[model samples]
Target: MTTTLEQTAMPEAEADQVRAVLEYYWAKEWTDGLPVVPVTEGYLAEFLAEVDRDPDEVLFSITHLNRHLTVRLAAINAAMAGCRPEYFPVVVAAWEAIAKEPHPARGIWQSTTGTAPFLVVNGPIRGEIGLNSQGNIFGSGFRANATIGRAIRLALINVFGLHPHKLDQATQGTPAKYSACIAENEEQSPWAPLHTEYGFEPTDSVVTAYVIRSVMHIEARHTMDPEQLALDFVDTIRRTGSLIHEYTSALLVLVPEHAEVFAAAGWSKEDLRDFVFEHATRPRSELVAVGKDALSHKTRWRLSSDHPDSMPDTAAASDDPDTVRVLSHRSSIQIMVAGANNAGVSAVVEVFTLNPPREFPFSYSRIERAGH
Candidate 1:
């Protein structure tokens, strides 16, 4: 639902009080209102042993804060999110991914664009953690999916002090700020998991987080001409101009049902990317149909003032399509074959951009499940 800001500064307290302290830090406004498991010293110690990072070491530094999230804080939030003791490692890794300096945390943490970051779990760990990658993957009811995502948000608030309407100035916050997570249907996926695409191995577990401004559904029957279906899909997005966001481009998550329509014809994720990049593009003139003054410059983005006339209307909005690239950067379009038992159509996970991706101490990582 809605997460408000946590209570004002809490002074130092005894060891036993830490749990109550975090809960208070979480409850007054830090949380999405779900009950949280307390993060105790013992829990933090256990996570540290696994990750083996210096407690004071800067695992990540937020550009928006004077504070840096310690391994202890990440662990505490992970614990609060009901992560298994072993899951702390994964939590830490996800933090590293989002905290990457260029990952775009600063501007996104406080943007009027009203977007929220979503964590996607890929690789073999999906089944180990019991994530729902197959049916209703994006829906609620999965422990790992829910908690891992929430753990990061908690870290953002408790660690970086980004609360609603204060530093995080969104007119209408999204559900992802509460909990947004999902796993890849690796068993059913035809291509390499996203982690592998980003450099991790198939055997390795990885977490990837991106700012998704909004999500939309792609409704189409399994047509004989999948390319034709794709054209319609592009047209669908073009009409709304969501792809032409003043801030960034939109994300399109393709489900298995829809993927197979292309697969039957042997169309790979790359094929989809190529097809989309080739056919789903708009001219600069067309992209700025709403005009250029729509977007504001973000500090997190490494943009050049070189193009004063890329589009008649884009001078002030944005110039670097690379930062906001949608269909081109194989990294931009994450294709996950998931959703529902029976379906001719699939839901697209359109993760709207935050800025450029942040690169800091942390990167996508996963926990080693107990006994695994």
Candidate 2:
């Protein structure tokens, strides 16, 4: 359940040895289709020293794979992913959150849907570690955002053996599968940070994980009207391809400009969620046209049997069958402000799993710094 690394200093390997190590990793498919940092005992020790927990401590386990991710292994992957020693806690916290997912952890990683673990970091640690929450936040130019996400992927491949075309059977994975991590632009936001909505303190450093199938950008620059912007978001969320399941949910990443628009209209995050929930609907005839009506029937059955008390009676009472709501509940829509204020750009991340467990899509864990 634990892996201990040798604490002795390791001299730098010669050029030949370094080349051999890289060759070995590539041949063994240990690398994520890219050259790794060539993790040495000395490099590993630096990362281990930054964590208070035992190196051998099992952060989480995938029972089906017979795999256990110990702190030492996590550090190894983190080091290989080019992470600084200080970044270890955030990486560890990410895996901790993934372990708490309601669905089988294996399914989340190995689903045919090509879903990836999307991480949203909040709290003071964003500044402490130089996470990019501003311009090109989702793209590149930030080490913490890039490697923290890569560390998780490396662990899944190296430790759990969820290698592509093998244990991990993804059908045309998105580029985000390589790295999908971002910090909330809490400073520019007009509302509370994401962690606070989960009852975490404003100062609590936290990482939230969601299984996302796709990250679609919504560009609505023409309007200052919040309702018009809401319509653009609604259209993206109600796209037929994204409606694979009736209980699907969405994480709307609003740019600061859009956030300001909502704030100016006296709209809270709740108001935005309510608006999306009420309007992001498709007529039953559309679902029938798209062959999703059977799935909708299944959703109705599940709602009636599993959550009769919380069923949408208003939608059910309507004589017209065209009143089908895409999201199962008002709580299904999550809004967070991120990206730059310059462009009228935002992103809508499609959640991978249906919400029968209701909390199927997300899990959160606090980041515990070493010295603090």
Over 1-372, each residue of candidate 2 has an lDDT whose tens digit, in order, gives: 554566644566676787888999899888889888888899899999887989889988988778899999999999999899999999999989988885545466787778888999999999999999998988989999999999999988999988899988888887778899999999999999999998999999999988888989998999999899999999999887776665578999999999999999999999999999888888766755765553333333223213323344234556765577777777778889999889999999988665453743688999997777
lDDT of each: 0.63, 0.84
For residue 16, what is the lDDT in candidate 1?
Answer: 49
Q: For all the candidates, what are their Cα RMSDs to the real structure?
A: 8.0, 7.2
TM-score of 1: 0.76
> What is the clash count of model 1?
26
Candidate 1 Cα misplacement greater than 4 A, ranges: 1-30, 101-105, 243-250, 283-289, 292-331, 354-372
Question: Whole-model lDDT, candidate 1?
Answer: 0.63
Off by over 4 Å in 2: 1-17, 104-106, 296-320, 355-357
**Top TM-score hit:** 2
Instruction: Give lDDT: candidate 2, residue 182.
Output: 96
